[model samples]
Target: MENKIHFQYLIDGDDFTRAGEASSDIKSKLKMMNINPDAVRRVAIAMYEGEINMIIHADGGTIDVDVYPDKLTMVLKDTGPGIPDIDKAMEEGYSTAPDNIVSLGFGAGMGLPNMKRASDEMEISSVVGQGTTVTMTVLF
Candidate 1:
């Protein structure tokens, strides 16, 4: 198998139904690559959370993934109402989502926490009116 592979996914804004598609596809690819189950699940869960966040908070975004022998790296970039306070957003059970989103079984305030828990490292950068970018890495 190749030592590395690259993939990109475009998230559709406000499309909660399709939010996890990219992560699902990535999981399949990892399975085909014969990667460890734990590694694949970590990557999938982290990426899925990021994907949903991009849709819910950032309108839409692009996900770039680099699959390697011993690690997985994902970059999620989006242009929307950027985070006003990253520290607050990172706190568990903190969410700025509207009531409607909360009704859909999402926006449970678990996205960031889940992503952080699933990845070895995660970095998020944002500007109030500009945009946000989240980078996550999981070690196999």
Candidate 2:
């Protein structure tokens, strides 16, 4: 591709049924674009985890994805109760998800970690009471 392709998605808070829609749609779009399969997988996994996080913790958010010739970037922004400790949140098996979400097999405390692992690069910014924004990039 010679130019960047962009996509935006709105996540519905507390809606497990619609949690993965954004990732799925992005996956399909990437596939149709003939993007590298591995890159597509990375984007899908990372974005899906972020999507689920929004539903479980942030009460939904907005995801913006940019597809470039050399990489794919995803920005997940939420206005929910922001994370108090980003370092703690990034650790595996460290989750703030409630019992109800855990019961549904949604929160295993691996969301951010998995997102970081799947993406080539990841950055997170948050304010304790305001919100959080996560930016991730995967090389194509």
Best-fitting candidate, scored by TM-score: 2
**Model 2, span 1-140: residue lDDT tens:** 55998999999996798889999999999999999999999999999999999988888989999999889989999998999899999999998899998898878889999999999999999998899999999999
Model 1, range 34-127, lDDT digits (tens) per residue?
9899999999999988888888888888999998888888999999889888889888999888888888887888889999999999999998
Tell me, by lDDT, which candidate is best. 2
Q: Which segments of candidate 2 are over 4 A away from where they belong? A: none
Q: For candidate 2, which ten residues in a row score worst on lDDT?
A: 12-21
Candidate 2 global TM-score: 0.96
Candidate 1's displacement at residue 4, Å, is 2.4
